[model samples]
Target: MTSPTVSVKRVSECFVKPQHDHSQDAKQPIYLTPFDLPFLNLNYSQKGLLFAKPPPSENQHFSITTFLNNLRNSLSATLTHFYPLAARLATRKQQNPPSYVIYIDPENSPGVKFIHATVDVSVSDILTSTYVPSVVHSFFDLNGAICHDGHTLPLLSIQVTELTDGIFIGGSVNHVLADGTSFWLFMSSWSQIFKSNVNENACFVSRTPIFKRWVLEQHDPITSLPFSYPDEFIERYERPQHLKERFFHFTTASVSKLKTKANTECNTEKISSLQAVSALLWRCVTRARHQPLNSETICKLVVSNRGRANPPMSEDYFGNPIGSVSATTTVEELMAHGLGCAALRIHEAVRSHDDKAVKTQVARWYRNPVVYKMSGLLPPNITHIGSSPRFDMYGCEFGLGKAVAARSGMMNKGDGKVTMYPGREGGGSMDVEVCLLPEYMMDLECDEEFISALIEE
Candidate 1:
């Protein structure tokens, strides 16, 4: 049976420029850090949707018109601090040597695009659906035309979709411009401004973004290393579209149970909830795939380096401060060692990314600046996990109360890809979204161990 499709009507589209002018640094190009280069060829954006129910009282002045006006105004104000987001990427035309640079050409560059849309489907219809709804994809502006080339695309695009019961504010930010933390920081700030009714004085000063690009730069001159261009990596990393996405909710109690089980197996060290959950999923997904016993399987864990910087970079410091750490084991070992072994491997891989290690890695990349070859080539038996359950996505409010739920529209949705989100109620509960080929998904659904771990909502 086919799931119902929501009809989305675009009401308006316009570019929202920064309220303040930043022409002084217009000609200067923000050079891409070695960390930012891997994302250059990847036109994919980080898409998030925040859903909020309508105002409670009829006497409330918060109508859709007022809400949108406030959002537009607030976004304009917020962009002043996040000016780089309003700019575009400048790529090398033939003879240009440095590859690509972000040009803050306020005069000619197109600012972030703002779109107003309406969906006929109600919010409850979506929340109650068994499968991941297609409407969630429509909420964001995922147009290929807008994100085809790093040079032409706006660094950010936002769509405000109104429904019968609530509203969905969808955001698509260029991956090169920011990481998950930076993205959420911008979002939280936007919500603050909207909640304050666009009052300039009410804007939180402490949350201001630092736009200095050199903070991540090394003091000494670094030797240039050879790197693959976006064209060379496109086909290798392109996600397969023949997979299905499903959301599995795990309550705090279930998470504790998994953690306890994993710890009991590994007598020396205790693994985190994140590691435990990843281990469980990794084991289940790998088994579902039914690969050869000797085949090597890898779980690519995305680790945030915010706290691991030598001096510890400020939590508010924007840009990508993230790196991938992987736990590798043979299929036979992974299946035989139980969840504790996999969890321990994951825990250690993450623990190894301490301050000194993270700093050393950054410096090494600086001297030999190049995108990792592992990024584009995900051979069979490999999975890349992005996002974290720590982010307070459900806490974001915009005058209409807190968000009921959140989901990623632009995350990689191919086989062995996973993204995690904090549960709506937000204790230690988690929402794990998994993507897999139909056969593997079918196997996963039938696995008794996997089914037993899930906490049915």
Candidate 2:
């Protein structure tokens, strides 16, 4: 077997001081500290070794340090972006540092640490492609371990090769901090930041998060942790072996029609487009399990608590929003019901619940530590939708070439798989990219009639 090239080394570790919020300004958003917060512990990792090439350079070479320096400066200016809750689970002192390595001892680690190159593709051809095939290949595996917690950072490497355009940009991120939408937003910003001409066209500076924990508590004063016992609902299923990715496109017209139907069924004025899709996906996942359709068979739904928590956080912070909503329903409840019924139930469960419930539940979980035990209560199929960074219009222009297509990479956490919701053009509809078991998706795909029904006419 051929040996690999490329190596990573940790240069230094710094003692980061903790920053506490003492601001009593009622106008300023109260932000929770990710460092000291409980319920932030989760493990995210995946490995996929694929092949691709970097962008081409006719007369000039791409500078790696320049890009890194730009990224640093961007972080410095947007300190909240780097230290935001969604991006970093831990606070200042607890924050994880991005790993930086060089090819000092490539021959030592062999293929395990270094990428095994096999393919005769030229460098220029690779870079010139609408999207760098190399970067696309890198997205398949999540190298989240490079960060302190499970936060993500852009990974890049440049070295002169006999083959001219040989380069790679890759890294892994935790699923918690940012969904695919957040990832793209950060990437696009990072690219602009690298160029040193950060145009206002490429940044999302929100005044506050959409959902907060405190707001949620006020709505759902009575809340319970979604899990009952570790073995009760979690240990029954086997983990999936093969992971596959597929895209599902829904028309705006179809979603609008569903929205009307959902709103009517729920006896409400409005129903979110995502709530409608969630209903369909919930049923499909349940069917994959071959479980009898019933409300008793529970599945968990996650909702972002960005502005839902106490004191309402500033939308300007870029890290992670406290995620605090979990909804459970049986396969039967979803299967036997129409989209409206499902939407109403899902909406009620999420909307009625608030941050106090999340805070209370978080407090309980910390006392008992439910993540390790309750992962199984989590459905074998998980879905997250309605957040895409591209809408912010941050152009992802690195010196090489802009990203042609960027979506969340495959996420293999516990027993369940994940599906990401991203914005699609047109005022009325949304797009979804599902990261599920190959077998599960195949089963859905084979059912042509069922799949067709899912599409809006």
Number of the top candidate by TM-score? 1
Model 2 ranges with Cα > 4 A deviation: 1-41, 44-137, 140-171, 174-185, 195-239, 366-402, 412-416, 424-428, 448-450, 453-456
Model 2 Cα shift for residue 246 (angstroms): 1.6
lDDT of 1 by residue, 1-102 (tens): 224554789999899977777767643566555556655545455556556565567426557777788888899888877777888766543334533233
- Please report, as a residue range, the 10-residue window in candidate 2 with the lowest summed lDDT: 102-111
lDDT of 1 at 10: 96
Which stretches of candidate 1 lie above 4 Å from their native place?
Answer: 1-5, 23-28, 55-61, 92-109, 145-148, 214-238, 363-377
Model 2 per-residue lDDT tens digits across residues 252-363: 6766776777788878875687776666666565566566554354434555554566665554433344443445666666677776777777777778657676567656
Q: CA lDDT of each candidate? A: 0.73, 0.41
State residue 35's C-alpha deviation in candidate 2, in Å: 9.0
Error of 2 at 419 (Å): 2.7
